[model samples]
Target: MEFTCISCGNPLSESDLELSINLGSAASMEEDVDLSGDESPPFALDAIDDSETMNFYSTMCTNEPMAESSTEAMPLCERCFESLAGSIIHDIQRTTRETGRYNEAIDQLSTVTPPPPPDLTALELEESQAMAEFQSVQAELHKLRRTLAEVRAEAEKTTADTEERWRAMNEAQREADAACEAARLHAAVSTNLTAMLASLREDATLALFPIVDCGTHATICGITLSSNDWAETGAALGVVAFLISVLQKKLDIFGQFTVSPQGPQSTIAIERQGKSTQVYPLHMARPTKKGAVQLGMACCCLLHTIAEVYVAQFPDDDAVSFERDGHSVDLDDRSESAESRRPIDAINGLSVVPEPRGAPSERWDLSWREALLCLGRVCRSTATLDPG
Candidate 1:
């Protein structure tokens, strides 16, 4: 026979999502009968054929005989199962409401009404009034006991509150103490830091002063300047070099200036330590630019000139260059020529000399003329004085 869901009438098979409810068999139902109350069985079962495994029993329900139970199993698909579950829940709620009503009826039955007092003598009535008074005193005693218990409980709560407040106050005090300690430490640190900064300022002033001062005054000149002064002048060149190196590393500017003896030629070239260097020869000349009398002086003057230009534009501690022997350079190039000529101050009166090329590029014959021309333009544009 084809089976359909009993709740939703959906066609169902073994493979489909389904539910099967197994009802108690007749044998199991017989076990529930109260045999001690009655000698006869509560239900009578009819015999079935050998092919039939199911049995049918007859029982009276509410003074009426029950209909025959179905032997075939009922199947429910997913949707039908959901609908049956809802019906079951509704039935349970209805049963619960009926149970509540039954409980209320039972409570009504449980209520007891004191029987009316028999005809009493005068002594018996007096005894009844005394007993009632005694009962009132007993109720009052019970009420007093409950009130005492509440008072004790309140005392315990108050004690706990006091202890909690004390704990909170102690914690707050600790936090305040910690804050004060931190403030003290910070003040000490600030004082120490201020002192340290003052010391560093003194040291930096002593170190950077000489280098910047010499560059600032443009006092570097070899002509008529003593050997000692020439050394200071050379130191000024080192300062300029150090500044340029820092710029190359930090900002990657490509401009470079170098002094070397060669046939008169001036050009720009890239120099590399462990890599390739490119040269852009702007102008090449074959003749020497200046005699030996002014070569060293010319170089010193050029370095001073570039240093003034650089410091004027970018005056920063990072640009401050110290020699390997520390930032101690005697900038007193007080030679007669350094004092009189002041090549940087007298730059306009100087002749155009070509930049010299080093031995490595001697064949290029770079001249210093263009370099001197460049310096002349810069000097005439700005009015700078030499320090006395």
Candidate 2:
């Protein structure tokens, strides 16, 4: 009869049959055998004859049920038998190891004593203390949060106040700068005005005494009185007298002698017992010896007045002295050297009577010219002095 492998349904070789017989025997005796120990094979191959092996296989097949309806005896092939034997061995080893571990667990359990139950009251007290600590820490954290908020608010307010103060300081600084600039401008304008006023004052004083020499003639306000004509001479004298009166009034000089000018017939008066008396006529169309004497006397008085005015106006200047009854004027330097005294003889020949008894003297005209020139020099010098 042909034998087939039970697992692969292929015809089995002789060697496969032998392997299957050994595997089948081992499976059948698996419970009784100590497979983990160093033991001999389940059955010796030498002891089993082919017929007996067949009988054993058949007997195993009978004992075990088959999936097919045919009740034939079948053995596994060599390859399938090896695979099945390896799986069975592996399962047995695993089961042996699991059984050893279960036995050790049972022994350990039997030797050990059980622990006592937990103390519920102590556990509850520890839990309550932990809860209290947690609450305390939470409260402190809340308070710290509130303090931080307040600190932040105060810091913000301080920043705002500082900004306000800085703005105020900046505004004040700007206003101060503007004020300083305005003051500087005002000071500059005041200085300019002061200089202008001084210049105008100097110009006005010079205008009041506009005396100048016109070639071969002396002029006052462009009027020449150098001619010997009686009317021209009289007019010149009258102008001189008028100027003297004006100077006296301008200088605020109130004295015993005063001049009254009336066109070409001007006169000088002297106070006698608090009454005014005309000393002399300054202009005369018909000259006479008596008139010459009076003219000389009047000229002397005028020179005295001029001297007084010069002294009052310029106290620090050299003193002017009259000599020869005002026929000559001199600047007295009051020095040790007599030559330091300078004489002005512009009016020297005015008092002298002419040889022909007053045929309009050329000396008189020359005298008037020199006198005008001298007066002009004094006025120009005065203007040059510092008003201060």
Candidate 3:
């Protein structure tokens, strides 16, 4: 078993001095009665057991109880035992001196005079008045707190409502700006296209007449057709139908255009077969339709530009830039020739024409599928152009 000094935690062996302390018995020191005046010892040394040495040492040492047994023994080196015994003797002398001082203090207290007691009735009346004032102040403080809370709530609510209104206004302004931009683009493209195709209006109508003759057997522009041919032709027809649909939507927007309490409203509603109708704000619809128109116009412009270049190179042809009915029909004499001249003259004066832009030293050749794709690409490029 390992043993160490309780005070310093130093190693201890069997040969070390054994210092016994009984903390439980030491704690009962105050209960021991004095027998000095009767000529008898307060404790009879002969009646004590061998373990009673620890209790006697404990009573002569600290006032606090220790956790060990009343007869517990501690082993310490000779030097540690001498130091502890000296400390215990010094404490006992100090306690004896303190006891003498305490007795003198008690004799002085017995001779001193005491103050008179307070008047009960007057103190009771003052305490009651003070308590009443305190309660009244508490009630007023509580009322003020409630008022402050209500004011803060009102201020917070007002701030929230103002922020909500501000957000709504900003949203409406953004929508308005978008609508205006789309309308501007739509107006510009539609006007230019209407002017450019003014002469082609009659020709385009005549081109459709051939479709009626095509009937069950598919033939367009006097060429033999197959299912694929018909599908491609249908795609072309879809392009025309798309234009008419856009026009109808534009008319609807104009018709429904009005001012309300909320603000101005104009939108396009598209109905799909066997599906729910999709509605769009005018700003979104206009830009979308404008893109489609721009692509179609790009194809038209390319064709017109090509014809203009051919006419400039071969001015002696009896037929105008375009042929009709296997006979030469002069577009120069057409009523809209003045408007057509602008685009033609502009193309003729270009430093580089569209044809030379593709592969150098080779003419631009395109298959039917390639042509359709190229037309789409050209339209996208043109749509990005700033009308201004």
Candidate 4:
């Protein structure tokens, strides 16, 4: 099936040429007097016309290019359109041929402006009105050309602005991702209470995954630790590593007790006899002078120290605070951080706010898919936390 040329109402087909020749030599014989010329210019002027004489008049009206012959209408084969649409070879050939023919016609007409001029008062008036109409149409055409150029310029500018906006957006997203990654790295080494606060804003997982949070783990925020996810829970991708302290929890919290050659002894207790403090005593034979008590006590003490460093939660001190050793600790206080005081300006300069539930958070919406693609590049993960 083929489509018709919308502009010319003509079927587009592969034809070398479709020349139109207006056989008007008869009309030229006497200006519509009669198609009667005996000499006939030594060539056919009635039954046939000179090719040059015919083609000149025909070009005026018939050469109206088919508007649908536009470059857009690729209905014409590629090589054909390239050949016909102002091909350099065709242009040179056409220019030489048409120029020679036109010059010949002009020379012939120059030698023959015969007879006295006829009074053409009414004809002159009609010609004057037609000239005025032509000038108005020409002015409108010029205006249309100017308007088209303006529209094209505006379109180009809009395209450029859109590209620049996209570039800027990508840069901002990269900075944000780098900052979030920094915060993620820092939070992993922080305490449990800080972990809870940071986990409350855990949307970073979504951007890194297609559907599931990390493709391997299920919802891990508040689930059992010793279940199937003993693997994932121990891994850093899920949550703060709280379960690793299970062994530490089993060890008593009181400072370890010691057994001397003279029964069990707590040097710390004797030192703080007046003050209120508790202690734990691990049963063992009198030191055996082998420092076994010292060794066990040291191991227990080291485990507790590690737990305090990584697993201990911040005190929710719901009481008033006082000074000891001239130190200002949160004995009991109900105030926020100084940054929180000016919450609006906190800049959150870098934060790891996780994806919101019901709807995609303001952090997720983007202008296009590539925006997030660029962000996914910065999402950092480590193998040491694999728990494998």
Best by TM-score: 2
In candidate 3, what are the lDDT values of residues 76-104, reduced to their tens digit?
A: 45566667666655655676699899999
Q: Give the poorly placed runs of model 3, Cα more than 4 Å off.
A: 1-107, 208-388
Better of 1 and 2 by TM-score: 2
Give RMSD to native, each candidate.
33.1, 22.7, 26.4, 39.8
For model 1, how does the per-residue alpha-carbon lDDT over 1-388 read when each residue is reduced to its tens digit?
6766555566777743223423224333544545455344312222222222222111111112333443334455656545544654565567659989999999888896768877678769989999999999999999999999999999999999999999999999999999999999999998997787556544432223233223222332212211234445345444444434433332232144333212233233444434454443323332233332243344445544544444443444343332212233222233556442354443553543332365544432224434544555554453232221
What does the lDDT come to for candidate 4? Answer: 0.35
TM-scores of all candidate predictions against the true structure: 0.24, 0.34, 0.29, 0.20
For model 2, residues 279-358, the per-residue Cα lDDT tens digits are 54455343654444434433433443355345446556443333342233333333545222212222232322232344
How much does candidate 2 score in TM-score?
0.34
lDDT of 4 by residue, 1-388 (tens): 6543323445555441221111122224324444466433322223323445434323322343322121122233333334333443454457659989999999999988699777799789999999999999999999999999999999999999999999899988999999999898777757666766455444222112111121112222333112232243233223322322222243222122222221232212111224543333322233332233222322222222222222223232122222212342231232566422221111121312233356333232222122112222211111112222
Winner by lDDT between candidate 3 and candidate 1 = 1
In candidate 4, which residue ranges exceed 4 Å CA deviation?
1-119, 189-388
Clashes of each: 13, 0, 1, 5
- C-alpha lDDT score of every prediction, in listed order: 0.45, 0.50, 0.43, 0.35
Highest lDDT scorer: 2
Better by lDDT, candidate 4 or 1:
1
- Which regions of candidate 2 fall more than 4 Å away from where they truly are? 1-94, 106-117, 200-388
